[model samples]
Target: MNSFLLALRASPLRWLLVPLVALDLTLILTRDGYWHGLWGDTGAAGQVPTLFLGVFAAAAAAWTSSLRRPSEVAETLGAMPRPGPQAELPRIAVVLCVFLVPYLVGQAVCFAVTASSWPPGFNQYLGYLLLGVASLLTATGLGWIIGRLLSSRWGAAAGALGWLLIVMAFDNDLSVVNGPARMQPDLLEISLRAAAALLLLVACLWLPYGPRITRVSPLPGLTVVLALVATAAAVGNPVIDERHGSRTKACVKGPTEICLWPEEEKYKPMAQDVLARAENLPPVLAKPDAVHSLGLVYTEDRRWGGDFDMDSGSVWAMADGLTMAISAETFAACREKDFKGFEAQLKADDQSVLALERWLEKRLAGGGEPEYREEGMTESMAKAVETGKEMADRPEAEQKAWATATVRNVLGKYCDR
Candidate 1:
């Protein structure tokens, strides 16, 4: 323990101070960025501790590098002729502690702070700590092993790149969090990956020196554990296929545990309903005669943002009233033979109208699906409204007349009114 601490203290802790300070500054400045628009937000401070991890990795890499050529301690140990396999245990234990304990503590602190405002019995923050520990250990271990393989210089650079990629993968919104779909990995997978990386590191450290081994093979043990754990995870994965698209590589990778965005058409019915109801819905959902402006309800609150998912409590709270109203409008428009006006309405309200248009154009250029059905707005009227939105602008009077005519046609044909 003394030796390990000495090693850590002896190193250039001063160099890491810059990044640690910078990370803290960034966290303080970006407090609002981490919010999910919920009761208790994580705020950017939640990620502040991770900065220590980066500094630790960099420091550990440099420290581990010095061990390559025998040190004064190694020389003294060599002189002890009959050194047992257990003799090196202290240093190894110290290494493990240095790599793991402090990071875990930091993560725990972050988790506790974030989880405080959450509902009682929710230990997600603890889970995050465990996750963070697993992550850092894995990364540091990999860096250690790589430093052992290619000179420490190249290893540090590689480790940094790997860390960046991992962060990018996590921030990607398209990936699913908990599912049996493709294109994303789960927390379990991430831990497994980390474990695998640690094993690889230990193996790299001990395996190269011929048969007179000072260490028990880490690979065999890790492999067995990983195989069993992975099999169990795959067997017990609960996300249904319908909720996720065909399983993709992202689903299996560590940290990305879910598939990318669900197949677009799966939610078509729900989307149609929202559009249909929204069109004819009175501004005030509680009262029938109130003319609620669509912009005020959807835009002001950012109800259409990709944030509030179907299963979320927020979505549930707003759905019955909001979705119902949106659905009515879309349905009413579709029923009215005013296809043009219907399209225009869709264009006006669709959260992803521009994106869809761009996507459509790209798809057409690439010979992909040109006629895409939106899962967010499902009713026939919503679909028509979406179509109108795709067209160039028409005169306001013409648009209004067309909308009225379409409504009459819908009433006469579909409602038999």
Candidate 2:
């Protein structure tokens, strides 16, 4: 214990860890709020501390391992009655604690701040935290082994750069780490990755270090085999796990209930206002009070520019979605019949749907002509618009009945056929 404390006090690398950890924490705090309250953002934020810690930890571990080369510590320790592994345990423990303490604290703080507002999936967050710890262990262990074996003056720089490149190239792109947009990695993937990292750490720790010409250690070889197996388990499964968090919805009550995913709850009022505009249609055309629900689907399409806005295009899209939902519900009554040969019918249905969408937009804009025009106006759509205008000229009751029937026919027989 005394020797460990003295070693720690003597090592300049220990002092360097403080500034690196502070920098990592600063980065995490600054970016944590940028994408707050969004699905997958929490796990992504959790990765920030790991990103900075891994590089510094690897470099520091290498430097620490190199310190023994200039001294008689290893020789003196070997001459003692105690075993080499047991004697060296304190130094290894100290180094690991130095790297891991900041990581654990930073992650806990990040999770706390995010959970207060965003409330992410606990299981997923825990899995990512475990993965981060395993990653740090792997990097540090590898660096320590390299330093011990090579004793190169450039070992620290090489360790830092090499680990950083490997992490950036693989961690962000691999599904086992961040997963794809709108998805989170499966528990199996996280588990396998964590296992592989730990196995590699074990291999680094157990493998004998020498100047040249050595036989392989059985423990390290077995660890390498197990690590490969764990990696295979991660890479073999090709299916991207769909994110259930995105489907988890919270609703706000109004004339029409506005349902949105929790990440999109900020736009509930905007969605309510849009639905209230939708309520202005004729009784039959308006959504029924019994089944009055508007589910907002948020798209990350570049054209949409992300999030709800008062822009004409965005308003039109929201109004269009309301009309589409109504049409879908109206068509549900006609599902018993089987329709075939739907190629032309599908085109006609699209035209009709677009016409209805345009009509709804005009109504929502207070019966004025739409200020913005949609691109790619098809000929069939123009004909449908003419037909819609004719129907609008009819008596109010007749117009309502015609609109309901058209939606049913188009969605049920026309689209399906």
Candidate 3:
């Protein structure tokens, strides 16, 4: 291995490496599967470049190994190769080109057949190219080191395994984007992080290979493994734990609470207070239901947890909130003739109302608390209950008038103060 490294160091091929690496990288960045899926709308559009990168990286690894094989070493030695970094670098460069051509050709086909546009422009392409080259070179270097440490075949196997692990861990949303073409680019970040870790692993595998021949070594390969593990821990955390499917699942049970799916009727106004206001100036107060019908609205097109709980004082706080949110959306959709937009708004509003109700309920249920005073006419009713028991012997009409006056006074205070 040392002899091979020295030979490579002495070869003229070294300078060609930079350009070959750049070419392969450019090819990968330009290929996009833009229209490959259904409707050409990719929820997973971000991952196309990473997929190409992985393929290129694997091919580059294999080609590099074949070029650096022991047979090549023997032949180079027999030819009395010039002792300079120039000679071997050219061979590495040639190998890189050979590996790159087939990969680039496939990408060309992918581009032509799909007629896809690289989502970003020249600057973005350059950025992706640089990123791809860095990742591939790192993998190649690591594969070279692994081959050296574990005999050629084991090294090749290690390289292949590393590549496979990276591709698998790229965060492809197979579970969701199935059956139709729904591409997403969200996994790109994860793929990039995985590729980076692979590169580090390659570095780790190679850096110690040169120094271990003379000194007593304690597993010269563990450094890369540990580094890869740590990177995975940091970059992979959010991807691994994300509850992607749960975004559509039912999470909210009541009208007053928010969840992915809220329950019915919790927000279906028993009354028609859709705007949360009083109407009917001819003197009767508008029914509370006429304005404050509970319902959920889908605002901003961002799917979130259903409405939060509002009717907490009731035995079924959660259920009530969920129910209200769903019903509200349904009700709004039915009313507006803009069924789609109405449903969306109702869901959002249900979420809002439930939140308000739950907050208010919490305030009302407290002790010596100011919230109790603000709970509409509940205080007045309690006072009425005490006074009514004392006036139990009064005639019905007199009692009714007195009660009416008291109720009007209480509700009037609520309206005025």
The model with the greater lDDT, 1 or 3, is 1
Off by over 4 Å in 3: 1-84, 106-135, 170-328, 332-417
Minimum summed lDDT over a 10-residue window in model 1 is located at 250-259
Sorting all predicted structures by TM-score, with the top scorer first, yields 2, 1, 3
Better of 2 and 3 by TM-score: 2
What's the lDDT for candidate 1? Answer: 0.39
Clashing pairs in 2: 342-417
**Per-residue alpha-carbon lDDT of candidate 1 for residues 287-390, written as tens digits (9 for 90 to 100):** 22222211112333444122113322221212333333333543554436645544554555633323223322322122223333446655654655455444
Task: Compose the digit string of candidate 3's lDDT tens values, residues 64-145.
Answer: 4434435665566446656433333444444344444433444344344333533311222222323334334444544444
Provide the overall lDDT of each model, using Cα atoms, as 2-decimal numbers: 0.39, 0.56, 0.37
- Tell me each candidate's TM-score: 0.47, 0.58, 0.34
- Cα deviation at 25, candidate 3, in Å, is 17
What lDDT is obtained when candidate 2 is compared to the true structure?
Answer: 0.56
**Model 1, runs deviating above 4 Å:** 13-29, 33-59, 66-74, 80-109, 112-121, 162-307, 310-417
